[model samples]
Target: MARKTIITCAVTGNLTTRDQHPGLPATPEEIAQACLDAADAGAAIAHIHVRDPETAKPSMDIGLYERVVELIREKNTDLILNLTTGPGGRFVPSDEDPAVAGPGTTIMPPEKRVEHVARIRPEICTLDFNTMNSGAQVVINTPRNVKIMAEIIRDNGVKPELELFDTGDIVMANDFLAAGHVEGPAMCSLVTGVKYGLPCTPDAMAMASRMLLAGTEWTGFGIGRFAFPMLVQSWLLGGHVRIGMEDTVYLGKGQLTAGNGELTARAREFIERLGGEIATTGEARQMLGLAQ
Candidate 1:
C-alpha cells in the first residue's frame, strides 16, 4: 500500500539564481504569489527564504520576513509557512587573512539567525545540523549556536525542521533529541547534492531514513540537477518531498524552470501516478504534529 506523501515548495532560496532561472521570485509580492500558486497547485507547505530586493541576496531582516508572511496569510490562509533559518550563517574566508570572514560571509549571532522566527512564529523553520565545506566557503553553525536557536524556536511554539546534509548531521540531531531540545516525533530534512555533503543516491537516502526515530517525520530534497530524482526516491522510501528553483535551475537538462508552481505540479503528478495521494495542509499538519 502506498503511504500519503506531502509536497512542499521552497519558493525562493537565499542565493542569487535569477540569472539561471528567469522566474525566480526576488521581491515580497513575488514570493507571496509564488507560495499562493504552489498551494493552489498541490503543495501542502511552502518553505520560504527571503532575499534582499536590491541584490537578491539572502537576508535575515524581520521586516522583510514579516511582509512576506503577512502577504501569504492575507492571500492564502491554508498554506503552511516554513521559513528558512539557514541563512545568516555563511562564512566566506577573507583573501588577505584567509582565516577571517571573506567578502561573501554573512555570519551573525545565533539569536540573530532565527530573529525572524522569533518575531514571525511561523509554523516551521529550518535548523542546519552540520556546518561543512559548502563549495569555497564554510557554513558555520556551532552546537552552542544551534542550542540557542533551538531553544528560541521551541519556546516560541515554532517547530525546527532540523536539516541533515550528511550522516554526521544525524548524530547532531540525535544529540539534540537526547538533550530534549526538540519535541517528540522529531522533524527533519535531509539535503543532498551540495558540493561537500552527502550524495543524492537511494542508498544514502535510505541510510539516513533508517537513522530517523520510529515516530519521527522527515522530508528529503536534492539540490541542482538532483531535484526530481530525489523527489521520486524520497517518496519511494516513505518520506515527504520538497522542490523548487531554490534547489535547481532547470526544468530539464537545458530548460530553465518557469516557477516553483511548475515544480510542485510535476511532483504531484508523479506521486499520483505512483498511486500515492498528495497530503493536504491539514493532513500534513497532523502528520508533523503541527497545530492546525
Candidate 2:
C-alpha cells in the first residue's frame, strides 16, 4: 500500500491578503463556505482564521470564530476544526515611545489570545513556537506566553499544533514537550517562506523535518509562490501538507485561485499522481489522534 497523505486547507489567514487577492474569504459566512468546499474537495482538516468583517483585517473576536465553527459543523459534522490562536500577537512598536504600541500592533496577553479556542473548543488550535521579525512587523509569542497558551489548550483538551518557522522554534517546542505542556507525539506545522525564518527550500524543509522528534505528527506549509512545490516536497518526504488562500492566492503563477477548494483539489491530485493515498477524515482523525 502507498503512504497516506493528509491534506489540510488553511481557509483564511490573519494577514492582509484580502486586499492582495480579493478571492480571500473575509466574512464568517464566506470562510465557512470555503471550508465546506475544501472538505468536499478532499481536505480532511480546515485551518481557520477570522477577519474583521468591515476592515477585512485580522480579528480576535470570539463571535466570528463561533459563527465559522457553527456553519462548518452544521454543513459537515465530521470536518476537523483547527482554529488559529496566532492572531493578536503582532507588535509594531511606536516611534516616539518605543514601549507603546504603534498603529499595526494588536498585542494581547496570552490568556486573551487563546480565549477564542477555550470558548469554541476546536479539535486543534495552533500554538506558535517562535517569535520573529516578519517584515517590518514583529510577531511576539514569548516563552511565558507560549507556556500559558499551551497550558490553556492542554487543559481544555485541545491539541496544540506547534507552528515552527525555524530550527530554534523546534528546539523550543521540544522544551514544551519535555515539560509535558503538550501531549506526547508532538504535532508541528513547519511554516516556510516567511521573512527571517527558514527559506522555502527542499533542503530547509527536510532539515526541519529531521528536527521533529520521532513519532511526532507533522505537516508542512509553504507560503506564496512556493506553496504547491512544497506540497509535493512534503508528501514525498512522508509528511502531510497544507494549502489554501491563506498561504497562496494563486492556483498557478499569475492566475488567481477560485478558493481554497481549488487548492485542495490540486493537492489531492498531486498526491495521487505521486503514488500516495489521500487519507479520509476518519483516517486523518486517527492519524492525528484527535477526538471523534
Candidate 3:
C-alpha cells in the first residue's frame, strides 16, 4: 500500500496580502469557507492565521479566531485546525533609536501570543522556533518565550506544530522535547526558502531532516516559487506536505491560484502522481494521535 500523506492548507498567512492575490480570504466567513473547500480538495488539515476584516492585517484577536473556528466546525468537524502563534514575534528597531521598537515591531508577551489557542482549543497550533532576520525586521522567538508558549499550548491539549527554519531551530526543538516543554516525537514543519534561514535546496532539507528527533512527524515546505518543488522534495524525504496561499499565490509559473482549494488540489495531484495517497481526515487524526 502506498504511504498516506497528510496535506495541510495554510490559507491567508500574515504577510500574504490582497495585492499578492486578490482572492486571499480575509473575512471570517471567507476563511472558514476556504478551509472547507480545501478539505474537500484533499487537505486533511488547515493551517490558519486570522486577519482583521477591515484592514486585512494579521490579528491576535480572540473573537476573530473564535468566529473562524466556529464557522469551520459548523461545516466540517473532521478537518484538523492548526492555528498560528507567529504574528507577535517580529521586531523592527527604530532608526533614530535602535534600542527602541519601530513601527513594525509586534513583540508581545508569550502568554498573549497563545491566548487564542488556549481559548479556541484547536487540534494543533504552530510554535515557531526561528529568531532570524526577516526583511528589515527580526523575528524574536527566544527560548524563554518559546517555553512559555509551549506550556500554554500543551495545557490546552493542543499539539504544537514545531516550525523549524534552520538547523539551530531543530536543535532548539530537540532541547524542548528533552526538557519536556513539548511532547516527545512531536509534529514539526521545516520552513525553507526564507532569506537568511533555511535555503530551498535538496541537500539543505536532507541535512535538516536528519537532525530531527527520531520518529518526529514532520512536514517540509517552502515559500514563494519553491513551494511546489519542496512539496515533492518533502515527500521524497519521507515527510508529510503543506501548501496554500500562505505559502504561495501562484499555482504554476506566473499562474495565480483561484483560492486555497486550487492550491490544495494541485498539491494532491502532485502527491498522487508520485504514487502516494492522500490521507482522509480520520486517518490523519489517527496518524497524529488526535482524538477522533
Candidate 4:
C-alpha cells in the first residue's frame, strides 16, 4: 500500500494579511467556512489562527476563537482542529528606550497565550520553541514559559505541535522532552524560509529531520515560495504536509489562490502525483493517536 500522508491546511495565519490575499478569511463565518471547504478538498487537519473581524489584524480574543469553533463544529465535526498558541510572543523594543516595548510588542504572560487553547481544547495546538529575530521584532519563547504552556495544553488533553524554527529550537525541544516538559514521540513542525531561522533547503530540512528524536511525528514546511517544494520534500522525508493562505497566497506564480480549499486541493494533487495517498480524517486521527 502507498503511504498515507496527512495534509494540514492553515487558513489564515497571524502574519498573513488581507492586503496580501484579499480572499483571506477574517470573519469567524469566513474562517469556519474555509476550514470546512479545506476538509472537503482533502485536508484532514485545519491549523487555525483568529483575527479581528473589523481590523483583520491578529487577535488573542477568546470570543473570536469560540465563534470560529462553534461555526466549524456546527457543519463539520470530523475535521481535526489544530489551534495556534504562537501569538503574544513578539517583542519590539522602542527606539527611544530599547528597554521598553515598542508599538508592535505583543509579549504577554505564558498563561494568557494558551488561554484559548485551554478553553477550546482542540485536538492540537502549536507550541513554539523558537526565540529569535523575526523581522524587526524578536519572538521570545523562554524555556520556563514554554514549559508552562506545555503543561496547560497537556492538562487539557490537547497535543502540542512543537514549531521548530531553527537548529537551537530543535535542541530545546529535545531538552524539553528529556525533562518531561513535553511528551515523547512528539508531534512537531519544522518551519523554514523565515529570515534568520532555518534556511529552506533540502539539506537543511533533511538535517533537521535527522536531529529530531526517534519516532517523532513531524511535518516540514516553508513559508512563501518554498511552500510547495518543501511539502514535497517533507513527504519524501517520510513526514506529513501542510499548506494554505497562511503559508502562501499564490497557487502559482502571479496567481492568488481562491481560498484555503484551492490551496489544499493543489497540495493533494502534488501528493497523489507522487504516488502517495492522502489520508482521510479518520485515518489521520488514528495516525496522530487522536480520539476518534
Candidate 5:
C-alpha cells in the first residue's frame, strides 16, 4: 500500500494582510472555524497563526491564542493542532541607523516566541530552524534561540515541526536532533519559495527533501503561485502536503481560493488520484509520534 499522505492546512500566516484576501481569518472565531472547516474538508492538521484583532497584524499575545485554541477544542474537531512559534522573529533594520532595529522589528526572547505553545500544549508546533531574509526584513532564529525554543516545546511534550527554508536549515535541524534539543523521529516542513530561500522548483524541493534526517517525517509547501505545484511535488517526492490561503490566495490563475476548506479539498483530490490515501488524525499522530 502507498504511504498515507497527511494534508496539513496552514490556516493563516504572519505577514499576509486583509487586502490580499478578505477571507483570511483575523479574529479567533474566524480562525477556529477555518481550522474546523479544513478538518471537515480533509486536512489532518491545522497550522495556525493568530492576528491582532484591531490591526489585523500578526501578534504573539497569549490571550488571542487561548481564544482560538479554546474555540477549536470546544467544537470537538479531529484536526491536530500545529501552532506556530514563528512570530517575534522579524528584524527590519532602520534606514537612518543600520545598527538599530527598525520600527517593524518584533524580536522577542525565546520565552515569548514559545509562550503560546507552552500554555496551550498543542500536539505540534512550528520551530523555524533557520534565519534568513524574508522580503525586506530578516527573520532571526539563531541556533542559540532555536535551541531554547525547541527545549521548551520538547519539555511541554509538544512535538516541534522543524521549518526548513533551505539546506542550511536542514543542517541546523539535524544538529538540533543530534544534540537532543528536538525529540526523536524528526518532523520537518520544507519551506521553499521565499525570495531569500530556496527557489520553488522540483530540483530544489528534492534537494531539500534529500537532506532530511534519516526517518524524518516531513512535508513541503510553497507560497502564492507555487503552492499547488509544491503540494504535487511533495506527494510525488514521498513526503506530505500543506495548502491554504496562508500559502496562496488563488485556487487557479485568476480565481481566488474560497477558503482553507476549499483548498484542502482540492489537495485531497490530488492525493487520492495519485493512489495515496489521506491520513486520519489518528494516523497522522502515529506517523509523527504525537501523543494519543
Candidate 6:
C-alpha cells in the first residue's frame, strides 16, 4: 500500500495583499470560498488567515474568525480547519531610536493571540515556535509567551500546528510537548526560504526534519520559487506538504496561479508522481487524531 500524504492548503497568509496578488483571498467570503475550492481540489486541510474586509490587513478580530469558521463548517464540515495565531507577533524596532518598537508592530499577549482558537475550536491552529527576522519586521514569540499560548490551545482541545522556522524552534516545540502544554502527537510546519531563517536548501530542510520529535506529523514549505520544490522534497523524505499563495505568489517563472485550488491540484500531482498517494480527509483525521 502506498503511504498516504496529507496536503494542507494555506489559502492566504497575512503577508500578501490585493495589490500584490489580486487572487489572494482577503474578505471572509473570499477566504471561505477559497477553502472550499481547495477542498474540492483535494486538500485534506485548509490553513486559514483572515484579513479585514475593507483594508485586507491581518486581523485578530474574533468576529471575523467566527464568520469564516461558520462559513467553512456550514458548507464543508470534513475539511480540517487550521487557524493562524501568527499575525500578532510582529515587532519592528525603531530605526531612529532602536530601543522602542517602531511603527507597524503588532504584538498581542499570548492568550489574546489564540483567543479565536479557544472560541472557534478548530481542529488545528498554528502555534509559531520561534522568533526570527522576517526581513520586514522582527517576528517575536518569546519562550514565556509561547508556553502560555500552548497551554491555552491545549486547554481548548485544539492541536497546535507547530510552526517552526529554524533548528532551535523544533527543540522549543518538543519542550512544549514534554511539558504537556501541547497534548498528544504534535504537528509541525518546517518553514523555509525566509530571510534570517533556514533557506530552502535541501540540507537545511533535512536538518530541520531530523530535529523533529519522532512520530511528529510534519510538513515543509518554502516561500516564493522554492515552494513547489519543497513540497516534493518533503514528501520524498516521509512527510506531508503545504502550498498556496501564502507561500508563493507565482506558480512558475511568470505564471500566476489561479487560486489556492490550482496550487492544491498541482501539489497532488507532485505527491502522486513521487509514488505517494494523497490522504482523504477521514484518513487524515485518523492520522492526526482529530475530533470527528
lDDT to native, each model? 0.88, 0.89, 0.94, 0.94, 0.90, 0.89
Q: For candidate 1, lDDT tens digit of each residue in 1-292?
A: 3467889999888774777776689889898999998998899999999878887767777888999999998978889999998887888988889777878888889999888898989999998888899888898889989999999999999988999999888988988898898777898898888878889999999999998877888888898888999999998888999988788867788888678888899989988998889999999998999897
Clashing pairs in 1: 92-102
Clash tally for model 2: 0
lDDT by residue (30-125, candidate 5, tens digit) is 999999999998899999999988888888889999999999999865679999998888899999997899999999899889988898999899
Report the C-alpha lDDT of model 3 over 1-292, residue by residue, as the tens digit. Answer: 5679999999989999999988889999999999999999999999999999998888889999999999999988889999999989999999999899999899999999999998889999999999999999999999999999999999999999999999999999999999999997689999999899999999999999999999888899999999999999999999999999999999899899999999999999999998999999888888888999
For model 2, residues 1-292, the per-residue Cα lDDT tens digits are: 5557889999888774767787778899999999999999999999999988887888888999999999888889998889998987899988999788999988889999999988889998999987999878899989999999999999998998999999999999988898887888888899989989988999999999998999988898799999999999888777999999889888998998888899999999998987888889888888889866
Q: Which stretches of candidate 6 lie above 4 Å from their native place?
A: none
Mark the 10 consecutive residues where model 4 has the least summed lDDT: 283-292
Q: Give model 1's TM-score versus the native structure.
A: 0.97
Give the range where candidate 6 is weakest over 10 consecutive residues by summed lDDT.
Answer: 176-185
Q: How much lDDT does candidate 3 score?
A: 0.94
For lDDT, candidate 1 versus 3, the one ahead is 3
The TM-score that candidate 6 achieves is 0.97
Off by over 4 Å in 2: none
In model 5, the worst 10-residue window by lDDT is 73-82
Superior by lDDT: candidate 2 or candidate 3:
3
> Model 4: what TM-score?
0.99
Give per-residue CA lDDT, model 4, range 20-122, as digits (tens): 9888999999999999999999999999999999999999999999999999999899999999999999999999998999999999999999999989899
| Per-residue lDDT of 292 in model 5 | 64
The superposed Cα distance between candidate 3 and the true structure at residue 203, in angstroms, equals 0.9
**Could you tally the backbone clashes for each prediction?**
1, 0, 0, 0, 0, 0
